[model samples]
Target: MDTKQLNYYAEQDKILIATDCIIFGFDNQSIKLLVFKRRIAPFAGKWSLIGSFVKKDESVKNAAKRVLTDITGLENVFMKQLKVYGSVDRDPGDRCITVGQYALIRIEDQDIELVEKHGAVWYDLDKMPDLVLDHNQLVEDALVQLRLKASYQPIGFELLPEKFTIPSLQKLYESIYQKQFDNRNFRKKIIALDILTKLEEKDKTSSKKGAYLYKFNRKKYDKLADAGINFKL
Candidate 1:
């Protein structure tokens, strides 16, 4: 490699660091993000990103997982850093580098009561309240990254229930896509993906005209993905 490229890598190796997780949860109808209520902050009681300083003992990703488990009492959720927000005035407290991560988690699977104990709550992405620091920017970047990844991966299903209605699936897409989608085209695309299997029954609780339920066929999606095929709806 060229010496200039080598120098760039060398400088990257010595950057300041921290971790922030934008935990996204699917609540039947919407995509939610996890935010921590700041206990000690210039903006106390106001919503802020879930975060931690990058300690000498753990890598950035591991520190993120640790924060998730410690705060939410949960583990093994899909965690990946989306971007590093390091504007000089981004944080009012001190000079800290915050790397944001987007996580996919099933809301029903978590212990909500315990989560609240840590001052953590799920914020509806559709109407997020004012956030402290550069948290608003973090959410913006995370959503874009998630949409790009979802187009290629079955990650849209990651936050969904095992059995879901087509409307619910469409709602999930609209939540991420942030726009209205034609029902006919959306349904056609979902079926054409062929990774969703129609369940034996329908979810009749919502309406008299029950919507058919479906589940992600991970096995088929995995095999197809392994063959370099992409699934998008």
Candidate 2:
């Protein structure tokens, strides 16, 4: 390295880069958030999202995944970058900028023991407690993204099991949007999308006649999505 280059680099501002994740899970009837009580200083014992400072050798996306895996013990889940929060005074301790990301997981698929070990709790979206720093804003942004994505794509399938009934799928959308959908209309729209495969089997737990089982046709969805078809619900 050249001495002049090193000298010029040393004169620039040094800032901290951090990543915060907003993990969302669906429990069939409602959407929930994974949060934990802060165990470190600067807000110890208060509710907060899973987060950590980006390591020198790790990318921001990897940092978020690492933090989520360390806390939830889950891997290969659906995650995406939301946006950056760089308010000058967002972090009281230092000049830190955070890249926000959101993840979607099936609530029943998580490792409960691991979550408990980290003191993480899943709270219903509408009933969550006050959060630390700008975390409240982070959750709001993630939810907005989730709803918008769900409107035009089958991203909500990430929160559902491999096999689910039409009613179950409808309930998931209703919960995400916090509104009730006409059962017949919802089913008609979803079926028209041609992205679901009807199975011979049925889920009998919900009714005497039992609801027929269906699986998301990812291949079909992808083909249609590429053609600019919207999966609005």
Candidate 3:
């Protein structure tokens, strides 16, 4: 490489790169989002997605993972890249661009103390508060991507426990679609997928009859998934 070629790239205007995470969690009955009060000057005290500027030596994905771990104290969670936001005045402090990423987590698995220590709060998606910058749009975009992915894949499993009741699974689907599903039809459709194994145990917490507990058969699910099985609810 020649010095002139290197200088050519250096002459271009510099802009800051950042990554924002739209962390979604499901409590088996409803979907929730994690937001925090900004601790910096530009939007101090305002609600904002967990985010940070991309470091010079790190990949954007790593930056997002770092931010998620820092804020939620959870690691090894899979994150999906939603889109990039680069509106000229998106950040009041400087010229910047941000990549949006979303991750689905089981609500009970999170470290509540760590989240609260960082001033983060989990808000039900339907009742989310006003957010800073274009965070609201970021969240909306994440939801669209989530819904699309959930229709074609078994991504909802990430939001649930190892063993769950049929009603719990139905509630999860209903929460994702933001509507009620016909119980009988929903059960028939899900059972037809053949991805779950009914356990002998039953959850008696909700009713006298008790619903059977089922575990996702990952081996079978993977085989079917590889065969292009559609997991639409």
Each prediction's TM-score versus the true structure:
0.87, 0.94, 0.94
Q: Give the lowest summed-lDDT range of ten residues in model 2.
A: 1-10
Instruction: Write the candidate numbers in order of decreasing TM-score.
Output: 2, 3, 1
Task: After superposing candidate 3 on the true structure, give the runs of residues whose Cα lies further than 4 Å from its correct spot.
Answer: 1-8
Per-residue CA lDDT of model 1 for 193-224, tens digit only, reads 78889988899988998999998998988888
RMSD of 1: 5.5
Candidate 1 residue pairs in backbone clash:
none
Residue-by-residue lDDT tens digits, candidate 2, 1-119? 56665656777899999999999998888889999998877899999998999999999999998988887788999999999999999988789999999999988888889899999
Query: Which 10-residue window in model 3 sums to the lowest lDDT?
Result: 1-10
The per-residue C-alpha lDDT of model 1 at residue 119 equals: 74
lDDT of 2: 0.92
